[model samples]
Target: MRYFGGLVHAIGSFARDRSGNFAVLFGMVASVLALGVGFAVNVSQLYNAKSSLQGVVDAAVTSTARDLTTGVIKEADANKSVQAFLDANSRAGILSADQIVLDKLTVDRTANTVQADVHVDLGLYFPIFSVGDMKRVAASTTAVYSDKTIEVAMMLDVTGSMAANWWAKTDKIGDLRTAASGAVEDLLDNNLDPKNPRVRVAIVPYAEAVNTGGLASTVFVEARYGSNVPPPIDAPVSVSLTLAPDKCATERKDKDGYADYSPDGPNTPRLDNDGKTYLAKVNRDDHMKTCPKPELIPLTADKQKLLDTITDFRADGVTAGGIAAQWGYYMLSPSWRSAIADAALGAGPANFDKKKVAKVAILMTDGQFNTAFAGGRGAPRSQNAGQKSRSNAEGICSNMKRDGIEIFTIGFDLDDPSMTMTERDQAKSVLKNCSTADTSSLKHYYEAATGTELAAAFDEITENIEKLAIQR
Candidate 1:
């Protein structure tokens, strides 16, 4: 009886001891806490990886859509393009490129959508209830895109200053050719359709005046050689009476001088000079020859024609930005449709329909506008020339914006050391004021200081225009 009691008492004492229970309980709690912490870390990692993956997929699909719309890649290559982009950007978060899998890619031309689905198998730090050691995070993205018809007019400056190099260390004329030509090629690439064209570009190269080409005789009022014979009403006094060559036309004296009226509506005034104008005094070889060499190429899809025309552009005469602006407007204005038709150019300057078409203008200059026209002759050869020209350009810009024409302005090397601070500021300000206000990532104003930057500016503008065409 005593032995039995002693054995029972010892067992009871063992059960009552709290020291052993504490260890066991602590072991259980530590295991649970470690698992909870591990699971939380895995969840955070998974969330981050998923978010990163989603961003990559979104960018890939959007880029693919843009390329498809721009004809940079065909429908057949879209999947490949997206895959390449994904592969390149897969290492975004804690995820490696090797872990990402492109599960599906769909390019629906009928729907104008590019869709991509991707997944990443992320190794977990700890396995949780009802979950494996790895988590499969998936992401899907789609971009909708379509092309719209666009009309663009580029107003290029061929003023004498373009022949001189500024801070850019390269001749502006040479750079203009490269930049403008490249832009044309990019803009018209696979864009021209015989049945339904999507893009048309007009080149308005301006100096002292715009070369009207075949329309000059029809639009220009004849002025007999030698000046002082009743200069057109409001015409400035001539230092020399010189005549615009056969294909050149100056400002209009009629009610439509600053207006975007058709050439048929009002005849442009005559510019007659005979070595008595300020141009004659300047002593520059081409100063006496007032007309720019590059004629206005109306809205056309002929890329090669445009390339050739600008390639032959020569820097001469003074900056006549106001006249050039007016011509740029005419190139897109429906009112001047007949003039373009009469010139044997294919039908263009389509009637304004904001919903169906986008009209855009790009005006580029390297120096201040120092020339203007009254009647048919140059504006008074004084400081008023610069002010008048800038005012006229801005006025035309306002009118264009009101008419739904989007304007972009580029000031090339305006910070040239040769120009006064005031002059540079005025030139820059004119361009800034002329441009359509910036919106989103599209900047309507650009100041390119070098030839490379100049080319880039053109490329950027083309890209933005392309984006506008392909709205997402």
Candidate 2:
């Protein structure tokens, strides 16, 4: 009877003992913690799956949109393109490829948009105390494809400095030609269409002056004679006397009733205060000397002609970047559209419409603006100028930007061996200021130290242009 009583007492003590309470409490806490950890793991997996699916969907839609804009594929092939991209970038660990479902793939031709909706059934890493073992994740993306018309004016520097060697290359001019041709190909390759090409390129090879060539009479007020004797004021001169073999043109003076940086028409004659013609001054003895002989090619979709023009580039003359920049702007200006049409270069829209067209100017220079001329009709000549040209360039750049023309400036080996650091900095600063402001989506300035770097710069610009053309 005593032994039975002791066993009962021991059982009662054990049940009332506080020392074993910790183990029971820890067990309860651990169960909850394990469930929380399991839920977190599943949540993390879902998040990862969502991100991966979203990336794939975005890429697929973007690719489809680009292909559609380029006419590389039709609406029927958009689904195939999206599927192929998704298959190529399958996230098997986070979400099974087989479980991924493309719910919708749409191409709106009228809207020029591509949209995709995707869903994935992601298997949970830990499904303890969960409603289901798998979670559904979805992603949707839309991309707009534009078929806007693109006009590009490429202003290249063909000065005497281009004759120097470029990064072990035989000739810097040759490297420039190669890089420029490559950029043209990148932008215009497969761009031709029978109805209307999406892109047109114009080349303005400039040095001391821009060569208007056959378009001079159409665009300029009057052709200047090569001789020092100013032609009789208000008297008609023979076209032969006025025309020169090398079509180097001087910038019109501000006093000629033409705004300092405004585009001029034939009716607006750039004449002296006395209403006399201003002859194109030739500082050098050789008539064709120091001239970038390649005539400017206006906006044209003829790729072969562009390539041929690039191939035929010859480097000469001093650097007059301001004049070159002005001509670059003119190439894209709607005011000059009629001039271009009359010259048989190409046709432009009747008016400037930013919604339907994108105008871009790529101005490249290898040196500073060291040469400039002011005054005519036996007036005291102002020569070997500097600040005047730079200021003019800045004004022109500001005007072009104000008119909604995108300006891109490239400083190719702008550092002069003879210049001080301050001078070099000034030169670069001027060029940078002349370019359009750098933004998140667009880069307007580039500095290339070597030929390879120059090529890379051109390539980058071409890629940007292509993106702009497709996403307008």
Candidate 3:
């Protein structure tokens, strides 16, 4: 009887023991931690899937929009384009490739917009505590593609400065040609239709003077001369000199005594005080030496012709950026449509609607605008032409911008190694002033320090132009 009573007391004491409480509490805490960790891991995976899906959607919509803007793909094909892009990029890491679904694609031709919605079923890495094994993640993206027609006027500087051999193991002018041509190809590739392309390009190669070549007679008035002996009517004699007819052109002056920067049709050709037409004359020494004689090629979609003209360019002449800028503006001006047509350059657009057409000028120069000469065949060079040239260039830029023409200025190796810092700063300042204000996150000014850099700058400009072309 006593043994039985002792066994009951021991059982009672064992049931009241507090020494084993820590083990039970630790077990409960561990269970809760495991569930929390599993839920967190699954949530992280879902977040990652969402991010990946969003990226795919964004890329697909952007590419489709670009192709649509360039007319590479029709609205009916937008869904195909997006699906193809997604298929090419889809992987089996965060999101299953086969689970990706293009929920909807909407294309508004009139609005020039492309929108896409995509959904993906993502399998959870750790489905714990009654959570589901899979979740549906979705993403939507929209892109607005501009349908505006693009007209580009490339005003290149073929001055003597471009011939400098300072660029390490590379010719500056050659680099420029390659870069400019590459830009042309990029802007027009897959973006043109033979019947009605959305893009057209013009080239204005300028030096101390702009050579009109075969188009000179059509644009300039008859040449006249002034002699030492006074004529019967107290006027200079009308003399015909034996010279190349397609050699040069006189600068157009504004009626307000400022540089004639307005693209208001052809200016009345200047005349000497003797009522004789003034002829454009180059320095006798630089006539054939430094003058780039390529006539300006007006707006055209002929890629081969444009490339050929750029390749055939030879660096010769003084930097006349103002004249080049003016010519660039003229190429896009509605007023000069008749002149362009008469010269057979190309049929100019009937009208310029800022909403439907984008007029852009790419002005590139390697040196300061420091040369200006009088109109006569052998007129003396101006003493203070550098300042005047800069002033004239700024005036032209202002006028062009006022007309809604976008200007992009490039200073290629403008900092002469042998020149002073002040001079280099001045050159850069001139180019900066000539460039239009930055708009839509696109900068209008660039400076290249080397030939490779110059080429890269042109390529960057080309990209910006392309983006601008497809995005309003």
RMSD of each: 8.9, 6.3, 7.3
Say which candidate scores most in lDDT: 1
TM-scores for every predicted model: 0.70, 0.75, 0.77
| Residue ranges of candidate 3 with Cα displaced over 4 Å | 1-42, 122-134, 164-170, 225-244, 254-258, 267-291, 349-351, 373-383, 417-425
Alpha carbon lDDT at 471, candidate 2: 50
Q: What does the lDDT read for residue 68 in candidate 2?
A: 73
Better of 2 and 3 by TM-score: 3
lDDT of 3 at 372: 46
Largest TM-score belongs to which candidate? Answer: 3
Per-residue alpha-carbon lDDT of candidate 3 for residues 226-297, written as tens digits (9 for 90 to 100): 232112233344433334444555355422123455576653344445565433221121222244667778
Who is ahead in lDDT, 1 or 2? 1
lDDT of 1: 0.76
lDDT accuracy of residue 437 in candidate 1: 95
lDDT of 2: 0.73
Where is model 2 more than 4 Å wrong at Cα? 1-45, 68-77, 106-113, 122-135, 143-145, 165-170, 190-195, 219-246, 253-260, 264-290, 349-351, 374-384, 419-426, 466-472
Supply candidate 3's per-residue lDDT for 299: 85
lDDT of each: 0.76, 0.73, 0.73
> What lDDT score goes with residue 365 in model 2?
82
Candidate 2, residue 219: lDDT: 28
